[model samples]
Target: MAFDGKLLANLSVLAAVVESGNFARAADALGLTASGVSRAISRMEARLGIRLLHRTTRSITLTDEGERFYAEVRPLLVGIEEAASHAGGASLSVRGRLRVNVDPLFSRHVLAPRLPEFMARHSDLEIELITRDDLGDIIGEGVDVAVRFGFPPSSSLVARQLLETRIITVASPAYLKKHGHPCTPADIASHTCIQFRDSQTRRPFDWEFHKGRKVVPVTTHGPLLVSDAGTLMSVCIAGGGLAQMMAIGVVQDHLARKKLVQVLPDWADERFPLYAFYPSRHHPAAKVRSFIDFCLEILA
Candidate 1:
């Protein structure tokens, strides 16, 4: 039997399709036509005499035989890329397309403002910062890393604590002036407090004030309910209403500029943790490590 020269290339195409969830996207990633990608899969299937993909008009999934084959081939594909990188002197380089999934608020206010600095430091790096309401399938979607508030959502992914920010309640000077200042957390209910709905849960968040061991849950209501952090912050800055937000990051800038002022500081003891999550790998690539370190430096 002849050694198949196209075996590795076809396997790579299959891996790309699995990572991208569709052939069109896989083709785009690999610089190939969609029909070309389809043909490659077809060739591999015919050669192996097994069905690899279950195709529908809208979605594509791996068949059992395909899944087993992919499981065997995935590591080889990864290792080949690493070997190629090492041979090309790119193993030590922080130069590759680094796809990061991040929160919308963090992307807009925190990362966007400071991204130029990172880009300057890593002139060869191509960074793609994708902002979505929730953390999607990082492994399946080919994401390098993800930064989000709170804790790790899944046990499968390795998580690192980037920073911890105090949960602070704030209001613009004009809003406080017009609505009268709420000296106590209890008094917030009487004023128009901006509400932020949780992305995972459609329900609005209940405000909480904390001081050491004491915790007070404050039920808040407002004329407007929002699901976006940027909009909530904007409304608070523009004297729309009072809002609770992280004291650091963009909120610190607001405080420095006198755009927003912290209210009830004595009771603001709760700290929100920010984490960086990545899929587990024995020998993670240089680009992934570089990105994670950069995040820690910025968050610090």
Candidate 2:
């Protein structure tokens, strides 16, 4: 079958519909009327002799054929768009949807607050930020970039070092006043310690401390064992217990505000590295590159 401009246009509409999850939303995304989008899909289905979508009163879902077709053609569609942008000399225009997967704590404490400035700089760019503790498959999820702790697990993707932040032990002033401050790492055993658990493993993170060349991991217990860093920090600020956290923007803000006091400052020595992981594409979309650079600048 000869593929014409109309077929390409309908395919684009189909992709928009699949991405947006509905006819109306897809229409809005493509700047077309709902009826126009529906008609385009109907035309494409008739021409291709395949039912692309299963439509209910409330929602629309792709048929098996539609799913397979989308999976094969979506990347091609993205490439075509990128090519058009480059051909039109709009390669510098950061105008597209940018889907990013980010660590929950980093998103909450660092990226989220800085997003407005990034958006203001690139007005045409749309951002979708998914924050979670676990690092999911970025390519499978259609994520352009992932801001995560540690290095990228798979060598298939390109990884860039964002920053290495020091982990510091902290406690609320009220908690310290009530229980007395722990001057040494060994004294942590006497204090109520808030523990952070690995989301995947369900094991508590051992608090690490260093003096000169000697480093040790101290196992401490508490009433609260949280899987979320933000919640753990909140509990510590509310006088729950001593918590060790990455000394990033949010922690520094809290420290400066006197909300949380650094405990065993001399002993805090562990560094957590953050990375920007993305697909190993030869030419990433301008939006992705722009956002990564923006993050690096703000984070620097």
Q: 107-201, model 2: which lDDT tens digit per residue?
A: 98788888899989888888898988877888898999888886457569988888998889999999999999897788998888998887546
For model 2, where is the 10-residue window of minimal lDDT? 84-93
Q: List the residue pairs that clash in candidate 1.
A: none
Error of 1 at 157 (Å): 0.8
Error of 2 at 202 (Å): 3.4
Per-residue CA lDDT of model 1 for 21-88, tens digit only, reads 99999999999999999999999999899999999999999999999999998888889889886646
For every model in order, what is the number of clashing pairs? Answer: 0, 0
Q: Which RMSD values do the candidates have, in order?
A: 15.1, 14.8
lDDT of each: 0.87, 0.86
